[model samples]
Target chain A: MLTAQVLYGLTACVIVALGLRGALLHASLLQRVVAINVMGAGVFMLLIAVAYRGPGLPPDPLPHALVLTGIVVAVSATALALALARRLHAEQDND
Target chain B: MNTTNLLVFDGLLLFSIVGLAWASLATTDERRSVILFMAFGLVLAVAWGRLLAPDVALAEAAIGAGLSGALLLAAVRKQSPGSSHTHANPDRNYSESGAKVVLQWLVTLLCAALAGTLAWALLHALSSAPHDTLPRAISDNLVASGVSNPVTAVLLNFRAYDTLLELAVLLTAVLGIFSLGQTTPGYQPAGPVFDGLVRWLVPVLILTAGYLLWVGAHAPGGAFQAGATLAAAGVVLRLTGRSRIGLPDGFVLRIIMAAGVGVFLLVGLTLLLLGRPFLGYPPAWAGALILLIETAAMLSIAATLLLAFVGGQPQSTAVNAAANRQREENSRC
Candidate 1:
C-alpha cells in the first residue's frame, strides 16, 4: 500500500513527465506556455512535499516565501512574454 | 503515507499534467494554447497550496496564474484572428532521416536520466539530513519580528536585505518597460459608465490592499502581495481609461518610486545610529519599523509595476476605456 506521500511523489513525477512531453512535442507558443506552467506546478508540488515534515514538525516557511516570490516573478515574466508575443503577431500580420 | 490518499493525489496531479501536455500537443491554434497555458498556471497554483506553501500559492494564483492569464488573454484579443492560426513548423527543412530520429531519442534519454538522477539525490539528502537549520532559525526569530508567520519573519527580518534588493529589481523592471515605449498603446479611453465603475472599485481595492499589508505583520499577506493587488487595480483602471499613464517621472511619481528604497535606506541608517548592525531591526521597534517600511514599499511597488505594464507616458482616458470595454467583454464571456 502506497502512502499519501508516496502517491504525491508519483503525482509530481507524472506531472513532470507530462510537462516534458508537452515541451518537446508542442510547437505552438501558447502550448509551450501551458507546458511551462505545468512544469512549474510540478516543481511547486515537490516543494510542498519537502515542506511537509511529519505530523508534529512546524511547516517550512522559507519555501513558502520563496515560492510566493517565484509566483510573482513568473507572472511578471509571463505577462512580458505575452506582450512580446502580441507585438510579434502584430508585426507578422503587417509583414 | 496513506496509500489511498497518496494514490488519489498522485492521480490528480498526473491527470492534470497529462491533460495539459495533451492540450499543448494537440492544439494547433496559438490562441487556444495560450488559454490552456493560463489554465495550467491556475492548476499549478492549487498544487503549490497543497504542498503546504500557502504564501507561494497565493502569489502564484494572483501573479502567476491571474495576472499572466489576463495579460495573455489581452494580447490574444489584440491579435487579428487570421494571424493566430499560422503555425511555424520547426521540422520543415529537416529530412526525415533515421539518424535524426535516433539522435533525438538519444538526447531525450540523456536528459531524462540526468533529471532522474538529480531528483533521486535531492530526495535522499532531504530524507537523511540530521538537522534542518533553516526552519529552526526562522522559528526562533519569528516572535522577535512580531510576526506569527515564520515566512514573514524570514522575508522581513532575517533576510530583509534580500527583500530590499528584490524591490529594487522590480523598480528596474519598471524602468526597462518604460524604455520599451509601448505604454498602454492598445488600450482605449474609458466612457462615463466606466468612471462609475472605477469610483466603486478603486476604494475597495485600496481598502483591501491596506488590510492585506497590515495583516502581513502576522499573517499570510505582505507588502509584495498587497502591492500586487493594488497594482492589479491600477492596471484595471489604466485599461479602462480612468487612470492615465503619466511620465511616472513626475515629482509625485519619483517620490513614490523612491519611497520603498528610501524607507529601507533610512531604517538601516537609523539602526546604524543606534549601534545596531545595518538592516538589523531593534527589539522594541522591529514590528513597527518593518510595517512602516513595507507600507511605503508596497505603494512604490504597486505604482511602479502598474506603470511598467502600461508602458511609458500615462494616458489615462483612452487606456481606461479600453480596459473597461475589455472587462465588460470578459465578464460576459
Candidate 2:
C-alpha cells in the first residue's frame, strides 16, 4: 500500500514532465496554457500523495488547505493568462 | 474482483489522468484540446477525492472543471472568425516540425530521469522529518478554536496570514486583468432554449453556495467552494444574456471586488488593537468571527471571479446594441 502511494507520486512526476515538454516544444500558446495547468495538477497530486500515508489516518489537513489556496491562486492566474490571450486575438482580428 | 482493492483503482486513475493530459496538450486542434482539457479537470476532481480531500474535490470540480472550462471555451470562441492559432502554418514547415520532434524526445528523457530519482527518494529514503508533529499541535489547539474541523481552523486561525494574502492575490489578478484590455466583450448569448436552462439553474446554485458556506465550519466546504459555486452561477447568467458581464465601471463594482481583502484587513486589525496578536480572536468568539470572515470572503470571491472573467468594463451603448442585434439575428436563423 505504501508502494502504491509512492507510485502515485511517480505518476505525478511524469505528469509534470509531460507538461514541461508541452510548454517547451509546442508552438501554440493555448497548448502552453494547457501544459502549465497540467503541471499544476501534478504538483497538487504530489503534495496530496505525500501527505496521504495510509487509509485510516486523519491525513494531513495542512496540505489539503494549502492545496485549496493553491487552486484558487491557479485559477486567478489562469484568468489573467486567458485574458492576455484574448486581447492578442482581438487585436489580430481587428487587423 | 476485490471490492476494497483501492490500489488497483488508484493505478487506473493515474493512468487515465496522465493519458488525458497528454491528449489535451498534444492535440493540434484548438477546440478539441480544450474539450479534452475540461475532461481532464473532471478527472482531477476524482483524483482529489481518492486523495481524501473532499473539500478540494468540491472546489476543483466547480472552479477547475466548471468555470475554467467555460472560460477557456469563451476565449477560444472569441477568435472563431478567421482565427489565427499560434502555429499559423503547418504543412509549409515540414523541416521545422521535424526539428521539433527531435527536441521533444530529448526533453522527455530528461523529465523521466528526474521523476525516477524523486520516486526513489520518496519510497526508500528521506528520513527524519517527524510525523504528527504539526498535526498534534493543531489538534491540541483545535478545541479553543470555534470550529472543530482541523483544516478550517488552520486556514482561518493558526495560519490566517496565508489566507489573507491569497485574498489579496485574487484581488490583484482581477486588477491586472482590467489593465489588459478595456473593450473585450465578456460573454455570448446563446438561444432562448439555453437561456431557459440558465434561468432555472441560477437560483438552485445560489442556495447551494449559501449552504456550502454555512456548512464549512464543521464540514468539507468553505468560502472558496461556496464562492466558486456562486461564480459559476454568475457565469451561467452571463452566457444566457440575462446578466451583464461588462457592466460599466461604478462604485458598487469596485467595492465588491475588493471587499474580501478589506474585510480581512479590518478583522486582523481589530484583533491586533484588542491585544490578541493580529488575527488571534478571543477563544469564545473565534467561531463567530470566522463565520463572519468567511461570509464576506464568499461574496468578494464571487464578484472578483466575475470581473476577472469579463476582463474589463462594458463597451459603449452602441456596441451593446450591435451585440443584441447580432444575437437576435443568430437566434432567428
Candidate 3:
C-alpha cells in the first residue's frame, strides 16, 4: 500500500520548491507574502507527515499543537506587517 | 497498489502547489499577489487537514488565511498609488545576466538537494527502533493532565514553559508595534451603512469569540483562537471610528498585559516553595490552574494584539459615542 507519508512527503517537496521560487522570483511585496506562506505550509505539511509513521502508536500531537499555535502567530504577524505596509503606501501616496 | 493511490494524491497536491507558485511568480501586481497568497494559505490548510492535522488546519484557516489576508489587504490599501510603479512589467528589463541566472539555478538546486536529504534522513531515523520518548511521556500523562487532547496537555502542562515564553514574545511584539509612531491616523469617518453594520456585528463577534474560548479546553478551539476573534471585533470597531486612541500606557493596560506573565511566575514560584521543581504541576490544582492562566493569557493577548493593530490607546467613550451617533444617523437617513 502506498502510505500516506510518502504522498505527503512528495507534496511537501513540491510546496517548498514553489515557495522558494515565489520568494526569489516575485519582486512585489504581495508575492513575497505568498511565498513565505507557501514555505510555512510546506513546513507544516512535513511536520504532519512525520507524525504519521506507526499504526499502533498515537500520532505525535505535540507538533500538531505547536504548528497550530505557529499558524495563529504567523497570521497575527502577517496582519501587523500588512498594516505597516498599507500605512507606508498611504504615506507615499500623500508625499 | 495502495502506493499508487498515494502517489496520485501526492501528484494532485504537487500540481496545485506548482501552479500556485507559477501564478504567484508571474503576477506583477502586489495587490493581486496578496490575494493569491491568501488563496494559497487556504489550500495549504486543506492539505494539512488531509494529512491528519485538523488542529493545524483550523489554525491555518483562521490565522494563516483569514487574518493574514486581512493584514495584507490592509497594507496594500495603505500603500501609495505610485508604489504600483515598482511592479515588474513584461515590457521592462526582466532578464538577469547569464552569471546571475546560473547562480540562481545553483541556489535552487542546493536548496532542493538539502531539503530532500533532510526528509530522507528523518524518515529513515523514524522507521528504525521507533521509540519516541517524548510522545510516550505525553500519552502516559494524558489522563493526569485532565485533557483528552494530547496536544492541549502538552501545551498547557508538559511544556508549559515554552507556552509562557511564547506569550511573552507576543506581548513584546505588541509593545514594539506600540512604540512605532501614531497608529491611529485620523481618517474620514465611516458612512451610515458601515456604521449600521458595525452596530449589529460587534456583539455577535464577541459572543462567538467567547464560545470558541470555552470550547478550546477540549476541541480545536483555544485562547489564541478566541483572542484573535475578539481582536477582529476590536479592529472593526476601531476602523469605524467607534473607538478612538486612548492612553496606551495607562495603569489598567499595564496590569492586563502583565496578568498572564504574573500568574505564570506566581504559579512557578508556588511550586518552588512547595519544594518541587519549577513548573511541576500540583496534582490537585493542575487543570484549574492551567485554565485560569490560559484565560488570563487570552485576555491579555487579545487586548495587546487589538491595541497593537489600533497602534494607540483608544479613547473608549469617544469611540462609543461616535458609534452610537452613527447608529442614530443611520436610522434617520
In order, the candidates keep a fraction of the true contacts of 0.44, 0.69, 0.46
User: What lDDT is reached at residue A75 by model 3?
Assistant: 61
| Steric overlap count per candidate | 28, 0, 15
lDDT tens per residue, model 1, B272-303: 99899998887779888889988998888787
Report RMSD (Å) for each prediction in the order shown: 6.3, 4.3, 6.4
Better of 2 and 3 by DockQ: 2
lDDT of 1 by residue, A51-95 (tens): 666444567787677666556555555555555565565456456
lDDT of 3 by residue, B1-333 (tens): 365675687678667766765575567776777777777777777777666666677667766776666666655554533365335444432356777678677767876886687567656755576557878888888778856677777777888887788777677666656554345443457899998998788888789778876676677666676766777777777668753422254688888877777788888899899998888887677778777877887777777767666654454566557757765775675
Top DockQ prediction, candidate number: 2
TM-score of chain A of each: 0.83, 0.91, 0.83
- The per-residue C-alpha lDDT of model 2 at residue B123 equals 62
Candidate 3 chain A weakest lDDT stretch, 10 residues: A78-87
Task: Tell me which of candidates 1 and 3 scores higher on TM-score.
Answer: 3
Model 3 regions more than 4 Å off:
A53-58, A76-95, B1-14, B81-100, B126-129, B184-200, B239-241, B244-249, B311-333
Task: Please give each candidate's TM-score.
Answer: 0.79, 0.89, 0.80
How far is A74's C-alpha from truth in model 2 (Å)?
0.4
